[model samples]
Target: MVDLSQYLPILLFLGVALVLSSAFVFLPMIAARFTGAHKPTAEKLTEYECGFPAFEDSRSQFDVRFYLVAILFIIFDLEAAFLYPWAVSVFKLGWLAWGSMMVFIAELALGLVYAWKKGALEWE
Candidate 1:
């Protein structure tokens, strides 16, 4: 049986990481409080421009198609990312890995086809 004490090093490492990360996040805020400027002016508060007055709010609604396309790009990008590593190590991997990858590719292809059929790929 494995001893609970065997995880002491990992626990210590996690504790140290937590402390360091907390310091990294909070130290900057503390330093800013001590040294940063707190002055506010109408010019600084206004939206920046190339000498053009603002016509609309910065927070604007986007079409659903924009998010759909973005998600599709991310999905395909991740697929290629995983494919490259697997392709490099293909010779060492067994038939099971090849079969699994084939299934993954097939599922992605089906999703792409579905998206295409639904006009999700079309830009208005």
Candidate 2:
């Protein structure tokens, strides 16, 4: 049988991490209950610093264009992230990796063009 003693340090480290993390999370909440001011007033409870009273519901409809642009930004951003690691390893990985990355980039470019044609990128 493989000696389980080799894993003892890892198990101890995990146990320490769990105890410390739980303390960090719950200690603050326990302290806050004893230390925080227990007061509620009408003005204090209302939303602050808006000069006029809120006219519309806070959860209001947003432009679909905003979400489209956000999603495009995230997609392209993740593509760059993936490219960085591949770029660093490219010398060792050679032509196959390079060709694969080129295909990935071409696909992203096509998506960008499609979004442009669909007017998903237009602000106005």
Candidate 3:
């Protein structure tokens, strides 16, 4: 039977983390109190983009193609991310995992072809 009380190292680690976080917050507050350099200017207050004055309203309409591509990218990227874990555990999971990943990739490829045919991938 393992003694649960032997977890003193974990308790010490938690205590160190708490102390470090508290110090981080406390030091910043103390420094801000002494530093009289806090000032708001027109340049600082205004939203600057690419070193140019923003000409149009930030809340402008975006193209649907942009959103479609973004969604497709996120979906496929997440699928690829999952593939990494499946690949590492392939020995344990056997041929089923490989087939499953292949199906997933095929679906993504089909989606990409469909998007291309529908002009969803075209920027112009």
Winning model by TM-score? 1
What residue runs in model 3 are displaced by over 4 Å at the alpha carbon?
1-39
Best-fitting candidate, measured by lDDT?
Answer: 2
RMSD of each: 4.3, 5.0, 6.4
Kindly report which residue pairs in candidate 3 clash with one another.
none
lDDT of 2 by residue, 1-124 (tens): 8999999999999999999999999988788678875456787778778766789987999999999999999999999999999999998999999999999999999999999999999887
Q: How far does residue 78 in candidate 2 sit from its true spot (Å)? A: 0.3
TM-score of 2: 0.65
Q: For all candidates, what are the clash counts? A: 0, 0, 0
**How well is each residue in 17-101 modelled by candidate 1, as lDDT tens digits?**
9999999999987886778654567987776765776678758888999999999999999999999999998879989899999
Candidate 3 lDDT over 12-105, as tens digits, reads 9999999999999898877876896556688787756587767799799998888998999998889879988998898899898889889888
Ranking of all candidate structures by their TM-score, best first: 1, 2, 3
TM-score of 3: 0.62
Greater lDDT among 1 and 3 belongs to 1
